[model samples]
Target: MESTTTKPDEAATEKPVVTRRLDRVFLELYNVAAFVSRFFKEVLMPPYEGKEIIRQFFEVGYKSLGLISLTGFITGIVFTNQSRPSLAEFGATSWLPSLIAIAIVRALAPLVTALIASGKVGSNIGAELGSMKVTEQIDAMEVSATNPYKFLVVSRVLATTFAIPTLTMYTIFVAMVGAFINVNANEATSFPAFIEQFFGAITYLDVFSSVIKSFVFGFTIGMVGCYKGYHSSKGTEGVGKAANSSVVTSMFLVFIEELLALQIVAALRAV
Candidate 1:
């Protein structure tokens, strides 16, 4: 019953490496950068896709809230347990809530949440876009008169821009709450004094800078993930590569941003 078609394995599976390197790495990065630039260019233009942006906002931001909260809870409890003994040795077990709040609010919670978010949302963005590219959906959108880049990239990027700071805010709040549980685990600390001391450590300046840095972190994460996914090649293998690369890149960027932000925070403190 076989027709006279060549066996599937008879076709060469290997591509000439040099010919593909431009597409595989260099052009891919260029294309991603270009796509992000184009997104910003068109995002403020007329005929805004408000509804789609909202949907993306919910999907990207609100959906990730629970994971952030759960992680915050665990981080608060474990961090306090581990650090309390040292502070207790100094007879400063009383400083537990104050210390935890400053660290969590200013740095730890936001940075760790972003790291986890990259693993979750960044990979999801990459795989989703890579799959769409593989399935010809982006091409089909173009044929249907849709600006696929605007329709796809802008909404998602904007969502990350807005949602991540919201998540950071939430993470800070939940971490303090969980730390309260830790404070009570040994002996109840005065809730009012604890609250006041925690808030004392948080200057408006610190809050403003921390929040702004988180937004930048979110934007970078979204851009990298969406860029890789939207330009994925070679079907399933390419999609997998895009997802892996997105998480790796986002995690690296998160840490770099943390270092930069900490330096800025220090400088601001000295002023």
Candidate 2:
């Protein structure tokens, strides 16, 4: 018989908790993937949200023009100014146009535009949807037999998907203009000379890759924002959390997409 009191092993006790947390993360990821899949499926189904999509497109694209343009111009100026000293040291000042154009077209413009939109559009969507959820507007729509998901989620997502590429293109043009002005201020480079070399360095492949990446970035931002908002809970606190999470998640997704896009671009170039 005897005194058989067993002590609990801390390691063994913690293992299950850690495993459950990991499982929860995996489950959340799966749920998000499923939500995105549902969005695509719903998008293709009846009662297309043409009008709402157009409206949201204007909201996401036109409303964002000023911010994007200002940031793009500033980016160009700062980038050129920073690189000039290095280029001058290496007797590569003449390469400025090509470098600026290539960087803007291939990476900077799209990345900056997407990030701005994620900050602006992502937060707006998340907060708007979260508020609607909290106020029961979404539920009321369902009660009235209106397809709220289509009107709210699909439209916004599609608008962002289409608008971001347009914004990226606009950003590239504006950034180039900024670089051109900055170049002239620093050197004897003429507008024509700058434009010639700028366009010369940029290949069709670069433009295509940037456009594709923008599309993906836009989709990711819109979907994540909507997902966060749609699932928001905990009353008003949830709305704030949703908005914050949307920006963070969207930015993270943008970087991930950029990395994958770069790999794809490299693979395509090799082919």
The TM-score values for the models, in the order shown, are: 0.88, 0.92
lDDT of 1 by residue, 162-219 (tens): 8888888888888888888888768587678778878876778768877898898889
Off by over 4 Å in 1: 1-29
lDDT of each: 0.85, 0.94
**lDDT score of residue 22 within candidate 1:** 55
Q: What value does the lDDT take at residue 230 in candidate 1? A: 89
What C-alpha lDDT, on a 0 to 100 scale, does residue 205 get in candidate 1? 77
- How far in Å is the alpha carbon of 19 misplaced in model 1? 13
lDDT of 2: 0.94
Candidate 2 lDDT at 75 equals 92
